[model samples]
Every structure is written in structure tokens, then in C-alpha cells.
Target: MTPQQYHVIALSSLGGAVAAGISDNDLGAISGYSLLSDNATLHAALWYPGSTSAIDLGTLGGVNSAVEWPNHALGEVVGISQTSQIDPLKEQWSCSYPAGSGFLPYTGQECRGFVSRFNRMRQLGTLGGNNSFATGSNIFGEVVGWAETSKRDPTCVAPQVLGFEAVRWGLEGDAHALPPLGQDPASAATAINDVGSVVGISGLCQNAVGALSAEHIVLWKDGIPHQLPTLGGSAWNTPMMLNDEGAVVGFSDRPGDNNGNNFNGHAFLWTSRNGTTDLGTLAGDAVSYAYSINNRNQIVGQSCTPGCASSRAFLYQHGTMYDLNTLLDSSSAGYSLIFANDISDEGTITGLAVSGAGSILAFRLVPNGGWSGSTMGASREGRSLPFRLRAGSFGRIMPNLTH
Candidate 1:
């Protein structure tokens, strides 16, 4: 199907001003997070194929929950949720974002990775620390993400004295820490395939975020961590998603970003055959990032123009990067599609979009086999991109270390 056959579908939030884009898709539903009406907390939510109202996946006895990845074949969802226990250190976990005008971290309550199925949620315990985050899962119910360990890492920033390690959880909810690269203090598993292969970042425990901490992109096969080459920088070499064919796609800093503080990396696709190939930005853009790669090897992400003053969503395939907005119908209203988070093998995509009224909203683009009568549109620049999916706020979204 051509992109012209695609149509936009807006999602509903839980009476809040913001609704993050869908992160995973099931046979008939999509999962993500939305702010609660109370405006202080968030809740994991699911939307049926055509329903406007979302089903709230209640939290694990706390104020927040998120669905980062859902195994559509198994009907299971994985993510992080807050608990009743308050964090003694009051550290802002990596998933935290600003709520409207007030910035809030997932503080106070201790959060943990979780698996939910049949409407029942089970927490995936940490590696002797207070928090965990689950990002991807396969049909086998095996989950991959990161968790805090008992060790107090010197590399970790203030209040976050405990280090974190990438973890794989069994169907029974047991945590298994993945091996790091050469005794590195921290690692995080972001995506896993049904074949039992997993990929993520191997880095220091600095701030528990992948930004400057990630030094290597790693793929684990048979429990052995193998280093994947970067575009030639020492930091921000992150792999955001991996497909079953062993193709990994993400973003990595170029050799010119050797300063160590820069995270402005170009999108990269790595394979056992090609090693690593830089996927350049859209026309007039300076940086790009890939968040998801389907089995067909089609990739989707965001590209920012020079100086990051403007951004656009992109779909890359067959060695060409096309602006997703450009693929929309030429007669449609102007909608700035900013960040493309994930694309299903069926050619459906979900991400953040700015409407004609300048309101930020999560949107889905479904490719139909035939044209549906809806007109097309043109792309407009100047809208801001978010650093993380914020509630009622628009900022620069960082390279998705948590996803």
C-alpha cells in the first residue's frame, strides 16, 4: 500500500491535556500511557482497533504506569509502574517527565518493572535495588529492560548511588541481569526477540540514563554480550530496536562528536553483514534517530533540521529516507508529524503530531490497501519536539534510552 492510502486517527486521553503515542500494537489494540484527570499521575492505557475511549490499565498500587512494549501474540504488556513505597532518596527515575508547568519525576514511590496479562499485573523485582523498567517482550513472555542493583556505583550521579544493570525476566517474573561490556557498571536491555536474542546499551552508571553513559551498543546471544560497532563516537551508541533477522537499528554519534558531551548522533542501522551504516537525516536536517525496526527492515524515527530548530517524522526503507509528512496525502491539512515511535509490519505508525491549532497529540497512521476518499496534506515546520513524551508540554525528546 502507498502512503497516500494512510489516514490519521486521534487517540483519547484520560481527561488530560496530553496522551503519549502508542508504543506497541496487539492484534486489535495499541498500548501507551496518558495522564490521569487528576493531572499529577499517569496510567497505562490500551485502545481497541477503532475505539475512541481507552481502557485504563490500572497501576500497581501507585500513581503511574506505562506500557512500553506489548507482545501482541501473547496478549501480554510490559512496562514500569509505581509502588506504594516512597523512595527514600527521592531520586527522579529515568521515566519521569514534567507535568504541565510543573516538572515532576517518578519520585517518592518506588517503581518496578511489570508484566500484565488477563487484566492482572505482576511486578518484576529489581536486582536488590528499588526500581526497574521493562521495555520489550516477545511471544514467549520473556521481558527485557533494566533494574537497579545493590551496588553503589561511583559513576552514578547524586542520590542515585545504586547502579543499574540490564535484566531479562522469565515468564515466572524472575530477574536475570545481562552481562555488561568488560565489567561496565551499568547496562540496559531495550528489545528482545522470540528467538531469545536481546539488545541494549552497555555503559557507565552515570545518571542511570544512556546519554553520555552509553559507550557501546550490545547484542546478547546465548548470554554472551557482543559489542556492535558505532558510527565512531565513544558515547550515545544506543540500539533502540532489534528484529529477529539480527538487524539492529538506532542512533550513534559521529566521529566529530568526540567531545563526549554531545549526543547529536545520526540514525544507524547495523547488521552482521553491513556492520553499521549511517542513515542520514531528511533534507535540510542535521540529525536523526531510529526508534523501531519491523521484521521487513522498515525503520521509523524523527529527524531534526540543523540546530534542531525544527523536526519531522521519517520512514526509511530500500536505502532511502522519506519524510513521513511528505508521504501524507498532498491535499490534506497541514500536520507536523514530529516523532515516529513505532511502525507495525502492516505499515501502521504511531507518534506525536501537532494539529493545525498547534495542540500536541498522539496520532496513528494506518495504510489502507486502497484510497479512502480522505484528502492529503502538506508538511509545515517550526513546531518543537519533546525531550520525553511530556504531559501538556512540548520539549526536545531525547534519544529513547528508556524505550
Candidate 2:
């Protein structure tokens, strides 16, 4: 029998060849990145994969853009980009090779659309408002996010002022708010799965008591909103990510479990098959929060140790939880695992690592015996160091992994 090999794909500061940005200025090394691959080539930004390298998927004139590689859909990347120099807000951009790439402007906008072989990024306008911000997209090109409205309350914040509403942008550019849960205020969809389900927080804008009015974890499916049952105590509940199978993961507060002020939160996984199950914390830990989950049902998040002296990244799979820091290079010091934002279908984890200087670097963890590379020393002045992996080694890393 042959042993399976895994590769950890991560991007850290090789010293100082800082990740480049729109102004040609260095914007810290890779703190995070999403893999964008076609049938032949795998494209990803160096943390903030900008418009310069790769194919120059231009922005909306902002400093950076975001990319999400759908597990079911290969060879395409969906993310928000700056479209016009006049108003540098986020417009959509799809990157494909040799396709003469460009921007996806909001419908009814004065800007012209660019050409890309992938799905056209049709800007979803706000709810009776002028601006809309997109956060997530599925393989079907269904986009979800919050939009502004014509009715404005001077006291409201940016998203709220726009009447922050979870909206779906599809064949129709006119954004429709996800049905609110009877709360005077509304919600915003943070992540959507291939099954057409959206997850996020729904709550009131403000309360006279100086506390958040009401916040609930919500799931929107078939155009209807269903509030996922909370863990008990709560002034708020937020769903950060959801998998295609409708398995929603987030943090919630349970009453009487801990002090009311910081309602002790436990990372939870909710599925139609199983209501809401708690993914327990690391040994001797009081609070834990799951930030992202992959299709394999593997969960990733952070947990605070007793006394909160340190918080460590954790991976929960097959009913088992392991600390991520223990799996990394032990010699590395002052390294704090912040948040595990996203996980690739192949088990590649991407997140930020805070160093002693407060510098945050992005990293990818490949399974052992998967990616083979020697660590090269940093360059003079501690700028950049080059560590190379075999060109085609990525596929071998996840040969048997499921999406």
C-alpha cells in the first residue's frame, strides 16, 4: 500500500519583496490569497493578486480587489474590482487567459464592459440606491451582498445608510433584499453556496438601550429567510460561511453559559440533517469560533486558551479537533494564528499570521510529503526570499480530496 502525500501551499514574506499593489507600491507580503485556476493554468494573486502580474484584471480604481474560486467551477475567479477612476468603488472582474479581460460595471452605469471568457460580471445595483457592494459569488454567477437605498437616515452607517439588505444579483441587475425576519432593520449575505443558500447576520440598526437591537444568524434559500436557532444567549449571531450542502458555520452566544456581557461563544455547525451541533473548543478553552468550512465537512477557526493569553487556529474534522499551530514549524516564534478565512476544496488553508512586529503574512498549509521545497534565506535588507515548488505539484497535493 502506498502512503498518501499532501502539500501545504502558503505565501509568506520571503523577507521583503513585499506584495505589490495598484500604485506599484509594496502593500505588505501575501497575507491572504485565493486560487484561480483554469483547466490548464492555476492563477492566484500574491496575497492581493493585483492587476499588474498574471493578466492585469483591472480594478474599480481602489487599492485592492477580492477573488473567490468556486470549487465546482474550475478555471474562473469572481471578485470585486475598481472600475472607474472617478468613483473608485468595487465593480466585478472575471479573469481568464487570452480573453482580453476588463471590468463588470453596475448596470445602468456609464462605464463600458470589458471582455472576459468567463461569466460576465453584471453589476447588481443597490436597492433603490446608487451604490452596491458584492461579497460572495457562486459558480452560477449568482452574486450576493448589501446595497444602498434612496431612503437615507443621517444617523445610519455606510452599509445601513444604504439600507443594508442581503440581496441576490443575477439575470436581473436590480437587487432584491432577502426577506427580513420581522425585524425593523435588515441583513446582508456574506457567503453563498452552490445550492443557492445564503448565510449572514440580521439585526436592528441601533437600540435606545445603547445595545445592538437584535442580531440573528439567518439562512436565505429559495428567496425566503430562515433564522437559524441560536445557541441560547445572544445579543447577536453571525454566520460567516456556508458549504454547498447547507452546512452553516458561525459563532453564537448561549445564556447562563457564561457572563452575559461577553456571552460565551461556541463555534457551531448547522445542517438540515442535524439542527445545530457544537464544534467544541481546544482543551481547556472557554470560547471558540469557526470562521470557514470546506466541502469535506472539515472546519477551520480559532479558539482562545484558558485565561486568553493566546488564541490558536484549529481544524475540526471527523469529530476531531487539532490545533493548527502544533502542525506548523515549531521553531517559529511570536507567530499568532489570526483567522482562517477560506479553505480550498483541496484542503489548502489560507489565513493571516501575525508576527512579532505586528506584520501580518498570508500562509497556505499543504499536507506533509506533498509539496517539497527548501527554505531559502531572506535577501539583503530583509526584503524578499525565493522558495520554489514544483510547477505541477499542486494537483498531486489534493489528488484524492473531495470538494
Candidate 3:
């Protein structure tokens, strides 16, 4: 028997008519999204998450900015805002609003030279070097990423230089940079769990005068960096996301994987019980990269399959890997599932689906219930009626689309 069908709920329009005329715009071309409430109305997008539909978190005069959903929190989103058009320095914005409105600023101006708003984009400010980037945010609004600091050292021949370190940000205090691992020149914190653990990559500067292949996976707890041993490799090992239970997922290369210019990397999962477990690639393929992990320990990423046209999205659960396309309703045309960015505790997933126009559209997969059969038939059955999850709660039942 075929797996149960899942309904594709349109959460936002990234490039539709409502989003046109927005300069250099991509509407709901969501890179990441999180459901704040099962009600579906209360959620966060990587960009604007509101009714007007095209209101982006105004950038620092730059054409590009990113929005990410903050875990399970309602009405909160975080992203990087470029501060200037001439000298664009990425600043972190912690955006929050009343339970039902669009995002409004919640923090002061903190400039970090470069930033990547991934996972849960709460800004993790700089150590002392005037630069920081955020990767993830936990339920309490705490954030983890990396920062740069100014350092004076006798080993340095010239003036005092800047150094990079992992960092954590929370309501308890100012942003604090996690300590470095050994003599590695730079370290970055990528993802954080609800209990406050963090993970990322650490490595020496990659250049002629400072070139050294010393990258390793590092974990941080209470603002301290602890090196996580690699799968016997030299180039670099990067951790992407961590679940609430402290299980971390990422990718690493083997010793012989990269010789001269050839490179080979494999996805891996790490936990306290198991140091690191390799998540092999699809049939006859060579490389894989894991990006996100849900609370149920289900891993979502992309892998190259032999004879396949390109890398496709995949979900690994119960020790089995399945192509994400298998979950979609094949009867629907123009729907091409791509990366699965984040999944909620309820098994709902948010990711991008490419249309025939090559535009990326954000989608939310909810249980295939509510309305089924023909649109008019379901509406006549009162199936389009909105159901509230709590007593004294109210919701707007969207009009059934006549198709």
C-alpha cells in the first residue's frame, strides 16, 4: 500500500503577484520556516510573515536579507540586515510582534561584518572583532553562532590581529564568545539545542602565510568549546544542526577522501552514546550532506544518487533513507520538492518546492485531513471550517478555493 497522502498547505507566496514590485524580491522563497503554533496562522518565515505578504524586514539598504523561524516560539523571527549600501555590514535583528501581527524590531543595533541566517537566525554577536553570525535559536530565545575578536599576541610579527570564536546570546547577559579549541585560528558555532548546547566547525586559517588543515567539529556548553573528534579526516568537518536531546548532525571527510584536488564527504550523526555514525549516501552515489534534524531524530538532507539527474532531498528515519519526493502527491503537477529545512515537533515540515517557472515556493506539509475530495464537495461538507485547538479560541476559516 502507498504511504498516506500529505496535504500541501500554502503558507506564503514568495514570488506571486502580491510580491511583485518589491525590489529584488523573492516572496516566501523561504530558506527556513518554523511553526509557532499548530493553528498555522501563528508562524514565522525567513522573511515577512504577515498578511500584507510582501513586507520584508527592511534590510540595511542592501538588496538581500534572510529570515528564519525561531523554533517553537510564536511570532518571532530572526535574520541579518545589511546596514549600508556603500559599506554593507550585516547586523542581526531579533524580530518579534504581538501574537498575531507582523515582525517588529526587538533589539538594538549590533553590527557583525558577515552573517549567515540559517536554521534559527537569532544573531550571535561578535567576540571583540566587530563581527558575528547566527545559526540557530532555542525555545528560550537563546542563540548560537560565531564571532570575531581582536587579539594581541607576541607570536604575531605585525600589529595585533583579529581572531574568531564561537558565541552564544541570551536574555541573561550580553553576547559571549566561546573559547577556542587548541591553536585553531578560527571557530564557528552553528546550531543549538533547547538545553543550550552548541555545535559547529573549527579550523586554522586557510591561506599561504597561515594555511593549515586543522578543521574539526567542536561542541560548546556554557560558553566553552570542546573538540569533537572527526571521522579521520583533515580538510574540515562542519556540524549543521542539533536536536533538543543533544544529538548533532553534520558532514566530514575521510583521510583518503581528499587527495590533491579530489574531495569526498559523508553525512554523520553524533550523540553522547555514539561518538559519530556515518549516514551513507544513496545507492551508487559518493557524497551526502545532512542539514536539519527534528525532535523525533528524523534527519533531512540531500544526497547524490547514481544515474539521478541531480542531488535530491532525503529523509532518514528508523535507519532507512527515503527520497523526499516520495512523500508528495504525485497527481499534482509542477511540484518539485527540494531541501527540507526544518521540521516541527508535530512532524510538519517546511521547505521549498520549485515550480515550472524555476521560482522557489515555500510550503508546509500538514496532515492530510481537514478538506479532501473536490473543493466544492469538501466545502459543502463544512470541511473548510477552521478548528481551534483550545477552548475559547477562535480562528478564521479561509474561503475554499474554487478550482
Candidate 4:
């Protein structure tokens, strides 16, 4: 398939929207966040295949909502939406803001994981706490993510004494707390396969921000947690997405002292056959992350230099990670494709793209030719690196649209 010109999604009239995740199937749904005309509040949005205007998934009564990960099938999406209740503790629960610019800042409020059905948002209750986040769902309608618990823990950093646990939610909103490795105070299940296997992080409750500085990558099979090895670092051992075949991909620190930051790790793929394989960064770039993995094991994320000031989107397949900028058409100058979030089985990618003048818009790239080597290659890194990081949504922000 030859690469075709990418299409920009139309989410807002003011043009500050970003697409964070896409469904795993070919021509799957697209989800993200966008500001209303006044830009006072944000809303989780879903777009049907080939549609430009987004369907606003209203909040659970609060002013903001975000879709981070949608199911590979239709009529299913998992994300965080705020409720009408105000946060009495004034805590900054980690999953509040998103990556990149052109979005509102974090305003902490009571939020929870939600599943939208027939145009209504249903809250997935926490393990006695007030906040929960749903990151991914399987075809069976089971959801996997993290949720706050009732008890306060001593290991927590300031302002975040409550503990959280990786959980699996059934179709009926029943919460099943996935076991953590040892006595770690927090765990977060980021992705689940169709067979009910889960993948996420197990770590100390450093700041109640879920699994930051995660001690180990954990995979749950039949409700048992198995520890996965890292790249020899102590933090940022994250597992982002899982394919149906049980292969998982994410980012991990490579024996560095980046203080457990996700921005300091290299993208990695894990399978039973090969274990964890490090997907190296673009030429001269220091960091990379794999946020979404399709059924074919094609991975998409971002690679950036130190501090993540300048980054480029990358697609990894067949042992090579290619910078997505080189794959763009010659007519599409003045645009830096940064932070590719998801890739469908058909090789359709969605993420944020910034123009030369610094305007941010959501873009989609469709493969005109199959997964053969396209224009993206290692030789194209010499172009001026103008990419700058805009703080984007936390966890997985996916959108769902229903008529």
C-alpha cells in the first residue's frame, strides 16, 4: 500500500482539538478531547469512520471529560469523566491533564471511569475511593484500568495518601481488583486482551498518580500477577497496550537515573518468544515510547530528545522504528507529526500534528501501500527538529460516538 495524504479531524470550530486513540480494527472509531467554542470546559469526543465533526460525550455531570482508549469493536469506549461533585481534598489526581498544548490545564475534580452506551455515560465505581480511570476495553466488554481505594497509605507522597489498584470491570460495572506484585501500594492495568489477560504497572504509591516510577511491569493471567523484567532501570516501567495474541508493548527506563520519568525510557515490545525487546529511538533522539500496538504488532508513539522539547512520531515494524515525519507527503511541509497515539490494523494512525506556525491539530495517516518500507527511514533525521511537547491527557484518552 502506498502512503496517502493524511486527513485532519474536525472537532472544534476554534481548532484546538487532539486525537489521542483509535480503535484497533481497520477503520475503527476515533476518540479524543476538544474545547467548546468558549473554551471554558473540555469534552470527550467520538468520531465515526470518515466523519470530521465529533460527537460530544457529555461528562458524568462535571465540566470536563476525556476519552483515552476505545475498544477494538464498535459501541465501546473507556476513559475518565468528571462528576458534579467537587474534590474536597483539592488533590491533583494524576490522570487529569493530557499531553501537548491547545488543551485546558488540570482543574482537579471528582472523576471516574465511564462507559458510554446508547449516548449515556455510566460510571465505573472505584474500590471505595472517589476517582477511577478506564484505559482499555476488550471485545467482551470487560474494561481494564486503575482505581483509587478507600484506605490511606503512608508511602504516598504529599497530597496523595489514598492507594489505587489495577482493576478489571465486567460488563455490568462490577469491579475486580487485580492483584499487585508483593506489597506495592499501587497498580494500574493499562490494557487487556480479548482473553482477559491484562498488562500494567506495579509500584509504590509515590504520589497517588497511579503507577509512576513503577517497580515492575506486571501481566495478569486468569487473575494472577506475573512480574515482567525491565531494561534494568528502577522507574518508568510502563506497559501501554496489548494485542489480542498476548504480546504487549510500552516504554521502560534503560538503566538510567531519570527519576522514574516516562519521558526517559525507550520503547519496548514483549512476547513470550523474545521477551522484552527494546525499540531504539530515532537517530540522535534520546527517548521513545510505544503507546499503541495493533494486531499486527505495529507500534506507534513518540521519540524525542532530552526534556522532550522536540519530538517526532514513530512507527515501529519489522525491527525498525521509522520517524513518521519522513513519511509525510512533500506537499505537507510546515508540519511536524508528534505523538502518534494509536494505529489500526489497516495502518491508519491518529495523533497530534503541529504546523510550522505552532498551531496544533489532530491528523490521521493511512497507508496507501502495505507495511513495506515507505519514505520514512533512518536517513531523514537531519531535518530541523522543531517539535515541542504540549502536556497531553493522562492515562489513555479515547472517544466514542453513538447516534
Best by TM-score: 1
Model 3 global lDDT (CA atoms, 0 to 1): 0.48
Query: What are the candidates' C-alpha RMSDs?
Result: 4.2, 12.2, 13.0, 4.7
Per residue, candidate 3 scores C-alpha lDDT tens digits across 35-132 of 22222312223433333232333344333334432233234344444333321222222221111211222133333322233332233345655445
- Cα lDDT for residue 99, model 1? 15
lDDT of 4: 0.70
Candidate 2, 96-152: lDDT as tens digits: 101212222122222221112233333446676545555555666566765555554
**Candidate 2 wrong stretches, greater than 4 Å:** 1-8, 12-58, 63-124, 153-162, 171-174, 207-214, 256-263, 305-309, 329-336, 354-359, 369-403
Cα lDDT computed for each candidate against the true fold: 0.73, 0.48, 0.48, 0.70
Tell me how far candidate 2 lies from the true structure as C-alpha RMSD in angstroms: 12.2
- Model 2 residue 175 CA deviation in Å: 2.3
After best superposition, candidate 4 residue 213: deviation in angstroms?
5.0
Sorted by lDDT (best first), the order is: 1, 4, 3, 2
